[model samples]
Target: MDSLKDVTLRPWPAPKKEELSQEDLLVKIEQLASERGHLRDITEKSLQEDIDAGKHIPDDTNDAVKQEAKEKEAPSRQERLEKVFNAGKEMYGHLEWAKFAATNALDLLSLVLSQDTNKRNLSTFSQTFREQGLNQGIPFGSFGISKENHEFHNRKPEELQRIQELEHKQKVVAQGARMEALDSAVDEILQAAKQLEKEVRRQTKYWQEIVAVSDQGWPLQRLRQNARHVPFGVRYGLPEAGDHFKARGFAPLQMDKDGSIILDPALALKPKTFRVRVSIDGKITGTSQLEVEVDTKDHSIQKSIQLARDSLFEEELYHEMSLETRQLLAYGVEFRDSVISVDAPLMGSTSHDRKLLIDCIPREDIVADSHHHEHDWLARNVAEALRLLLAHEHSMRLYRRSQSPPPLTARTQEQAPPPLLRTLLAVFRHLEGVDSLYVCLEMVANTLNSAGLEVTLDTTRETSWAILAESLKEPSKRGLSATDQLLEIFRKPFDGRATLTLPTSNGVQFESLTIVTRTIIGQPTFGTEHKLTLPSSLTSDLHLFQQLKFSSVKEVTSYLDWILPLHIAHRLLKSEYSSRATIKSHDSGITISSRECKRGSAFSTDIKVELLEGKLKATALTASPLSETEHTEQSHTWNGGHSSTSFKQVIQNWVG
Candidate 1:
C-alpha cells in the first residue's frame, strides 16, 4: 500500500475579544479569590508532602473559561425565562383564536350539511367573529384602525359610491361560488345513496351463500388476509395430514359474480385419484374404484372440497409409497417415473405371484381392467386397507402430539414418518403366510383323523380381532376414545396363531403345538415370521427346545413336516409299545421287536411319514425271517387320489 497521503491539519483560531480588565471584572475576581485564600501548589515538594497537605480550590478554580461560564450562566437563564413568558403570551392568543375558529368552522360545516338550506351565509359568520373581538388579537378580517391618509370621509360622493359598488360586486361573486358548491354537494349525496343501496344488496347475497356453505357441515375459518372478495375459508383436509398437505387444505371461498363461492387457487388444481391395480402374468386383474364423475361447468363449493380432499389423500398415499421403495429394495419394490412396483401375492408361492402396481391418475381417466374379476376383491381390499392405514396414521399423529413431548435439544432426532405402506405390506404378508400354513395343517389333521387317529386343530386370524368385543367392554385410560384405541391396532405388529394336539395322547394330555405368526415392518423384523412352539415333552430330546422361528411360511411348514413325524415316532410310539418299539435312527422312523403268531421270529419295521407336493405319504418296511414275502414294503400317499391312512396303521401292519 502506498504511504497514506500527507494530510495538513487546519488551525481554527479563537475569536479575539476586548479584555474584561477594562470593566474591572478580572480585578474583582482576583480580589474575591484573594479573600477566599487560593490553594497553594505543592508540585515542588515530595509526593508524601502533597498527600499530607489537604488542599482546597476556589469554586472558579482561577480559570478564565470557568469564571466566564459561571458569570454568563445566570444572565442566560434569566433571558430564557423572559423569552418563554413572551412565547406563552403569543401562544395563548393563538390558542384562543384557534378554539373560536374551530367551533365556528364546525357550526358552518353543520349548516352546509344540514337537510334544509341555511338562511345565514359566510358574511354573517364573519360579522359574528368580529363581534367576538377576534380582530384585536388575531388577523381576522379587513377591519383595522381608521387613518387620515385613507380619507374616505373627504372623498367625493361619486368615488365613495364607486368603492361601494366594487365591494357589492365582490360579495356577488362569493355568493355564486357558494351556491355552486351547494349544488355539487347535493349531486354527491344522490350518487352516494345509490352506491350504498347496491352495496347492501351485494353484502346480503354474499352472506346468504356463506350461510348455505356453513350449514352444509363444512368447517369455516376466518381468513386473516385476502378478505377482499372472500372473507372466510373452508377446512376440508384431514387434521393430521402432512404439513404441506395441511397447508393445501385451507382455501379462501372467493365469491364470484353470481354470489356463489368459487374454489381457491390451491384447490383448483386438476383432481386425481389413487389407483391400486393387481397385475398377474402381465394382465390387469383388478383395480380400485374411481371417483364419481363431476360436471366441470357446475363445480360447486361442496364438490370442489370433496375433490380436493380426495386428491390430497391420493397424493399423500403415493408420496408415502414412494418413500417406502427406498427401504424395500430387497423385496423387489421399485419406484420409477412416479410409479410404485411391489409384490402382493395372495399366497406364498411363485405360481401365484402377483404384482401390485400403484399410481395416481386424473379422476376422469378411464381403465377397463374388468376381464378377470377374480382378484378384484383382493385389489379392492388392499386399496381399502391402505386407506384405513393412512387414516390410522392421521390419528396417531394427533395421539403423539397429545403426549408429553421429548425435551428440547440441539441434536435433532428425525422422527420417522407414518408407515402407511409398510403396515399395508405387513398386513398382506402376515395374512398370506399364516393362512397358507393353517390351510396345510388342516389338510394334514383331516388325513390323520380319517385314519382312526384323533387330532385337534385350531387357528385364529388375529389375536386382537379375536377378543375385540371383550377388550372394548372395559373403560379406556387417558383421554383416548375407543375409536382411537382401536386404530392403535395398526401401529403394532400383526399376530396370528394356530394350535394343534398330537393324536396318540388325546386332548387330555399337554401335547399341543402352537404356531405363532408375527409380522412387523421395521426394526429387527424386515418380513413376515412364524414360530412353532412344541410341547416341552417332545422338545427335550430335540434341538428345537420347544421353540423354533422361521422367516417364511415355506420354511416353517417344512420344519413342521420333519418335526411332527419325528416327535410321533420317538415320543408317542416308543412309549406305547414299551420295550417292543424302539426309535430306529431318529427322524420319522421306529422298529417293533415282537414274536409272530406261528413262526415265533423277531422283526423290525421302519416307517417314515412326510409331506410330498400337496400330499401326505407314509412308508413302511419290514425285515424278518418269520414267513414274510421277499422285499416286503407298504407305502401310501394321501391327497393324490390315494386312500387316506395314518402312520400308526402302517407301523402295525409291518411289524405285528
Candidate 2:
C-alpha cells in the first residue's frame, strides 16, 4: 500500500575489485559475475520474486532499511493508477456493426438498381464509379496536380491491354540482354582462372630451378631494383671482388616462357683461359692448354654457371696483368696483343735465352699441341701458378676488407691493382739466380766428393716456402691467414739459401758455407743478388772474413772455382805433409822436403804441392851426389772421379 513517490528503491550491490592484478581481477570478476546474476539480467519478474521471498524487507538494521520499512508501512495512498480514463467515441472506435448493416442495405439497393456509363449511354446495371476521377488538378486545395501522363488514368481498357502486351515484349528483350551480360561475366571468370593456373605453373617451375641452382652452392640475392623478367640474381663471379670491379659480379636470372631461367648477357658470353707457353731460344719448349669441362647441351644450368665463373676469373686475370705490364716494362715483361712475354735466362747457357710466353686465349682456341713438349710440366705449372696467384689476390681482397676501414675523406686516392706481374717477375728472377747457384755448388761438391773429400750440399728455392708448414701451425696475432701470408711473400722481395760443406772439412767437422740469393722486381735494389758466407774456420784459414757478394751466377761460380782449391791446398795438403812440409806461401802453395844418407851415397827429394780447381797437384825433384844421371823430375796430377789417381802414390815414388 505504498504510493509511487514514497516507495524507496533499493540499489544492487557492485563487486569489490581493488588491489588486484589484471589476471586476478579478471578471475575475480568472472567468479563474481557467475555467483551473482548481472544487473542487466534482473527483470521485474525477478524483482517481484525477491520481494515475494521477503528480501529487502525492513528490519532495524540501518537507516536505509528503516527508511524502506517506513515507506512500505506509510504507502497506503493510491497514486499513478492505470485504467482510470475512458475511450472517446471520436477517435477510438470503428463501427463494425453499423458498417455491416449499411453494406448489406447498399447491396440490397444495388440488386435492384441499374448501372450506366457515358461510353455506352445506358446499361442494365447499377452505375459504377470505377472509371471516374475526382481530381480537378490546380485550385482544388491540399493536393498537387501531376503534369505527366499516367498509363491507365484516362485510357480505355483496350488501350491499357495493348500497353501491357508491349511491356511484356520489352521485358522479354531485357531478360535476354541480362542473360548475355551474365554469360560474358562467366567467360571472364573462366579465363581468369586459367590464367592464374598458368601463372602458378610458371612460378613453380622457376622457383624449382632456382632451388636447384641454390643447392649447387651458388649465391642468390633479391634484386634491389626489380627487373621486368628477373626477380633474383645469381652471383657466380668471384666474391673477393667486393664490388671493386667496375662491372657487377652478379647477373639477373630471367624467366622464360617455359619457366626456365634465361642466361643473362654475362653468362651468354664465351670463356677464356691462359695459354702459358714455355719458349726457349725462339722455340716452344712447352705449352699449357686449359680445357674446360662442359656439357654439350647449353640447357644445363651448371654449365652456364661454370662458364660465367671461368670467364670472370680469366678476364680479371688478363686485365690485371695488362695493367701490371705498365710497371714491369723494365723487367722484360710486356703485354702486347693480349700476350705477356717474360725473360727467363737459363742457369749456365749464355747463348740461349729462355722466355715464358703467356697469352690469354679463349678455351676453344687452344688446340692442345699435337706433341707433348719436353717442358710441358713447366708450362703447365706456370699457368697453374698464375691462376693460383689470381685466386690468392682475391683472398687478399677479402682480408683487406676485414680490417678496420680508414676515415671517410673527400680526397679519393687511386689504388694500384695487385702486383701480379711484379710477383711473377720477382719469383722468376729469384729462382733463376738460386737455381743457378745451387747447380754450380752441386757440381763442385760432387767433384770434390769424387776426389775422396767428404762434401755435401742442399738448397731451397725460397725460404718462405720452405718454412710455410711451420708458419701455418700457429695462429697469427695479426689475423693473417697462412695462405695469405704465403701469397704475400710473392709480392715482396724473394730470399733463397743454399748450404755446402767447406772444402777439406771432413764428416768429422761440420764447417760449412752458406749462399743467400735475393731478388726484387723494382726499387733501390733491382734484380737478383747472391751473397756467400764461408765457415768461420775456413774464413780464418783463407784470410777472408766478410761475406762475398756477386751480381751474377757466373761471377759467383768463378769466385768459388778459385777459393775452394785454395782452402784445400792451404789447410788439407799442408796438414797432410806433417813435419816434412814447409808452409812458405800458406796462401796457395805448400813445399815438402826429404833427405836420406846411406853408407856410399846421399839422396834428397823436394816436392811442391798446390791445389787448383778443386784438385791436388804435386811436382817432385830427385837428386844424388853420386852422379848427374841421378837428377830426375816427376810430376803427378790427381783429378777427381778416379781411384787410380792419387797424389800420395806419385810423391812416394819421387822420394824413393
TM-score for predicted model 1 compared with the true structure = 0.69
Off by over 4 Å in 1: 1-184, 223-230, 255-262, 368-376, 505-510, 541-544, 596-604, 624-630, 640-650
Q: Top model by TM-score, which number?
A: 1
The 10-residue segment of model 1 with minimum total lDDT is 138-147
Candidate 1, residues 63-89: lDDT per residue as tens digits? 766678878876677798997997798
Q: Which stretches of candidate 2 lie over 4 Å from their true place?
A: 1-173, 242-246, 292-295, 366-373, 405-414, 477-493, 503-510, 575-587, 596-639, 647-656
TM-score of each: 0.69, 0.66
Per-residue lDDT of candidate 2, residues 340-457 (tens digit): 8988777657889789888777776745556448988988887778888888888877777889899999999787877777777787778778877787776677666655667778
